[model samples]
Target: MELAVFLLRLLVGILAFPVYLLHFLGFWSNICKKLFPPSMVVFSAIYNHQTSSKKREHFTNLQKFAGPSGKLSLLELGCGTGANFKFYPPGCRVTCVDPNPNFEKFLIKSVAESRHLQFERFVVAPGEDMHQVADGSVDVVVTTTVLCSVKDQEQVIKEVRRVLRPGGAFCFWEHVIAKPSTWTYFWQQVFHPLWFLLFGGCNLTRESWKTIEQAGFSQLQLQHVQTSPILGLVRPHIIGYAVK
Candidate 1:
């Protein structure tokens, strides 16, 4: 049993590396967009609609944190499919960066038809190494459901700080550690080995928000929604803003 388990783990790790490489090169992202474009559209629509109570409350919080949009320079790290582009205020110069070239293509397709949006660039690399983005160039940085998969969470936060101007806003929505159910943790721990193998290197137990705070972001405003505990195991659905 022990050797079998070890071999299984080895296989998972080996398979995960290729998934990560493909995702980094934008292959999986493009396939995902084509596979479920409607789901993507609906998800974006839910976030953009302030009338929904949850979205309204989140938007209100965002408004207090982000203030105005005129001349706002926005950066989204791990912007899969760039679905959130339409949610951000119009007129702000948006930049979406992801390691997946496939995701960049989907982003281009998603926004190609929209004339009102203005984006300065679409980057196909991880944000942790932003040699392409200039220092102190961004006004707002957003990360939605991206941190769980980032290989070097600490480095990414530091890069974000370096790129944002002083007093700039950083917004995030992510999953985190949960309690009241050891079962959730167990399943996550069990499935994680296979999950990462199949779906890029997305680990189930990445405490990214805590890492964000440690990376020098301050003036923090946060909101936590306790969902069905099982879903919280992998999708805690957290939202917050921090100032740089």
Candidate 2:
């Protein structure tokens, strides 16, 4: 049994060596920044197809924030490939923020395709520190599948609240940790390290909902739901909006 286990470990290590080497050499970051946008585009199409009804239900909440001109000023943190642009109401002004500068080119392409949305700017900043965006300036803040990868969820939520006007909304849909007793949670724990290393710092086991809940939003409405089964450990999701 010991020898068999040793051989299994050896085989796993050998298979994983190339990935580790890329990370060690800092090439993985650049590679992921370039490759992730296109991959997310494909994934977004499939994901949206599967969860269209749920997304529509959640996004409808945005309509409440439209100003007298019927347009809302929106900011999205970690806006990879602008996947959420299609969901915004027509004529909404959108500011995209992401830590990866490489995403700007693909984001611009997405902006061009989304004629309904007015492109404000793409700020190259992480969610934790979006100092470029003025405080209390945006009517709405959106983040989807973003908090799980951020270095500090609390700081990100703080920034979200800071950048929103009084009574403005903070909208989010994020995959989160499953219940402790579940097999999915076990797998999430097992896969977390490799997933973080390979997938732009995403944490499969992050309880992002907890961070949002404790952020002191004036009013919060959130729901826990399961998304596409193909998401595996990340199928558990929380979707909601909070008023600041």
Candidate 3:
């Protein structure tokens, strides 16, 4: 019975790892919106759940800050599957970019199926290397849980600033390394190598907030909201807006 149980677990791992790796490598970026529909649903549910009291308070505050209106031209970098489609106002035009060509397939399908919002265009190229996108063309650029994986983090932030028009907002929610926690640091140092290898280039120990600041974000407002209840391995979140 023990051997049978072990075999079952191994089989599940074998099947799951390849799928996980494909998504991580952005190899499946095109089909990702459809391939991970269930995960998209789950993430949407979580975001929607934040509509309650405490979460709603935070949401309302962010909404005011976001200035959601018809005139805003938004750009989402590494917009995996367009999970935040519901966040934008209906008439606000959005442009989505992902480095991997795979995003074209999945994002196109997801965008077509969704009723309310529509993207102005979906491009396949690294947003950080924004030669393809015209300069000062964007009103706002957003990234979520994506900065940790980029190979050239600084370059990307500079690109975000470049693409955004004057007075444009760049918003993000990213997980970064925590300070004064030696134990968590040690674990992150150890696990990050393997994690990066298997799950794309995501390192948990990056100082993403500082990176954003250094990338010429002149008007910056930051929020370090805690994600985990436990002491160690807390995903100290960086959420806020930076303006060019």
Candidate whose TM-score is highest: 2
Q: Name the candidate, 1 or 2, with the larger TM-score value.
A: 2
Across 22-73, the per-residue lDDT of candidate 3 in tens digits comes to 7678775455534444454555456445432433333233323334353667
Off by over 4 Å in 3: 1-70, 228-234
Ranking of all predicted structures according to TM-score, beginning with the best and ending with the worst: 2, 1, 3
Candidate 1, 60-105: lDDT as tens digits: 4333334344466778898777666556665667788888665555
Clash pairs, model 3 backbone:
29-102, 29-103, 30-102, 30-103, 30-106
Q: Write the per-residue lDDT of candidate 2 for residues 1-244, one digit (tens) a residue.
A: 4454456546655678887789889898888877877787788788888887888778877978865667799998889888788888888899999998878888888898999989999999998899999999899999999989999999999999999999899999999999886878766766666678768889998888889889999999999999989878789999999999
Lowest lDDT sum, 10 consecutive residues, model 2, at: 1-10
Better of 2 and 3 by TM-score: 2
Q: Candidates' lDDT values, in order?
A: 0.68, 0.86, 0.67
Clashes of 2: 0
Off by over 4 Å in 1: 1-69, 227-233
TM-score of each: 0.74, 0.91, 0.72
Compared to the true structure, candidate 3 yields what TM-score?
0.72
Error of 1 at 21 (Å): 16
